[model samples]
Target: MSVSLDPVNIADKLSLIDELWTQRKIAGLNDYEIKLAKLKGEFVWHTHPETDELFVVVSGRLTIRLREGDVVLGPGELYVVPRGVEHCPVAEEETAVMLVEPVGTLNTGDTGGPMTRAAEPL
Candidate 1:
């Protein structure tokens, strides 16, 4: 397989996504995957036992609710949920976010539900 050297525009990729809470893969790095998703409400509470999950806010606001406390982020900000930590992300309005995690990491982590989805390539 050949790798494309072209740039992945975050805005352009996000614009193509129509469903909320569904992540679409944009690129890969080593064994990790970079994905984009639009969020409009609350996500399921879950935990990733082996890998830390990264969340970068591209637009709007996101509040990651944890057992300890809530971490809020706005555009251009980011927060990493440590491995084994339970977290649920909430967005009051439409929000765009970038997620970085190991390839094949399920969005729902340990909690498998209807909201769980495999990140598909854009």
Candidate 2:
């Protein structure tokens, strides 16, 4: 007998990078989006006005910083930045993270600083 299969998983199909990668999409009734980001080094500081953002560390370590304080997240750790809050992200080494936020949300929020925005995937 022969069998056929789709042979692909949606969750695994979408990767934003060829090596180090990220994946994202708008989801939920509130138009929130889900994102998967992989990183190393430091990211620009920024904020989001209309929505809060949630990050979950899937592998390695992630550091989240704010003007007032900072937090480090390791595997299975999670963090949330309230709407209109300013924050930054950094990874000492390679790290994988998942982010959730509303659709049309700006990666940089109001700052518009360099690295403020992410280009929509083609």
Candidate 3:
């Protein structure tokens, strides 16, 4: 097996998106992966049945909508969406975020929609 990782600029990995968030994987360990995403709009409501997801805002604003309420995040802020809790992520404009989740954890979680995808290295 081989493993490699390096320092990342974070912002430099975000890709331009016209409609939805674009995620770029930056690093991974034995059980988890780090991914950066450029978000500009709302994502579907979903949940991770197996693991929690951690999101750290790198820039712009982001909101995680839940049945109880919503957790809003901004630059330099972070939030953890507990496993199996249905939620939706929304961004008013271009927002950069770093996500840490279990390896192979689907981006769309329990909902395998068109946006569902395996993370790709930046």
Candidate 4:
């Protein structure tokens, strides 16, 4: 049997825990997944060696610092960081974001350290 779902309030479904960043799995499309994330402060600089990451700002603002430059995104804005491009995401305030990427893509990407951990499936 096939399972399906109705339209969901993505932001409302995210669990706000003690972690500086929280993510909820929204849905999966073939080999890709859509996730909702609530973030604050800065994330480690990393890169996905073989997958691109699509970020859609839901609320507040996010700045993606890249080697070449930085991209600032506001609500309803979207940006895609190509594979192998190093980036660090920063949110001066609490920000809600939606991410679309391949299912196996790690939140920490290529770099691994204290700041890196496999994304917990929600």
Candidate 5:
């Protein structure tokens, strides 16, 4: 069977998510999460063991640092970091970004850095 969902106002929801910097489960079956993250400065290097992370720049530029090199994603650009890879996200200026990931995935993985466990939107 197929299901249809009512249109949601992502902008409005973004406000709430941004306030909390938490993950919101969009589709349970698919383990999809929609999150709004505000970044300034640099983040801890980390990795996810079981899920790839999708990051879309919503307002400003974001830089992802990997062991190999760094990639900069601009507004409207999306990038995916494969699982089991070490990466760190950074922004010189305040940046707003949308993230998609599987349920229960940690913002920081094996690194267990300071930002490893953060609050999530229920």
Candidate 6:
């Protein structure tokens, strides 16, 4: 297999995204995929039973709300939602985030509804 030596520019990739809550796959590492998403408003409460989800804030703020509490992240910060833990992601304003999860993992997790989307290549 071939690998890219050039950097994957986050800002450039994020610029290609027009819709909120849509994830764009930027790179892949092993069995995990690196994705970028623009988010606003609240997402559905869901859980990934098979893998943990990593959320890294690129711009603005994000809150990962859980039954236990809420984990807030700012630009350059990140949070990991443990597997099988129910959580909802909320962003007051337009937020740019990077998600690291297993390839083929759905954004909506256990609750598959309208918000669910397959991450397409950037």
Per-candidate TM equals 0.97, 0.75, 0.88, 0.89, 0.80, 0.97
Name the weakest run of 10 consecutive residues (lDDT summed) in model 3.
11-20
- Which model is ahead, 2 or 4, in terms of lDDT? 4
Ranking by TM-score: 6, 1, 4, 3, 5, 2
Give the top-scoring candidate (lDDT).
1
lDDT of each: 0.97, 0.71, 0.84, 0.84, 0.75, 0.96
lDDT string for model 4 (35-113, tens) is 8888899999999999989999988999999999999999999999999999999999988899998887778888877
lDDT of each residue in 1-122, candidate 3, tens digit only = 66445666665666432234656678877688998888888999999999999999988999999999999999999999989999999999878889999888888998998899887776
Clashes of 1: 0
- The C-alpha stretches of model 1 lying farther than 4 A from their native spots are 1-3
- Cα lDDT tens digits, model 1, 1-122, are 99787998999999899999999999989999999999998999999999999999999999999999999999999999999999999999999999999999999999999999999999
**Residue 106 error for model 6, in Å?**
0.3
Stretches of model 6 off by over 4 angstroms after superposition: none
Q: The CA-based lDDT of model 2 is what?
A: 0.71
Off by over 4 Å in 5: 1-6, 17-29
For model 2, give the 10-residue run with minimal summed lDDT.
19-28
How many clashing residue pairs appear in each of the predictions shown? Answer: 0, 2, 0, 0, 0, 0
User: Which residue pairs overlap in candidate 1's backbone?
Assistant: none
CA lDDT for candidate 5: 0.75
Query: How do these models rank on lDDT, best leading?
Result: 1, 6, 3, 4, 5, 2
Residue 116 of model 3, lDDT score: 92
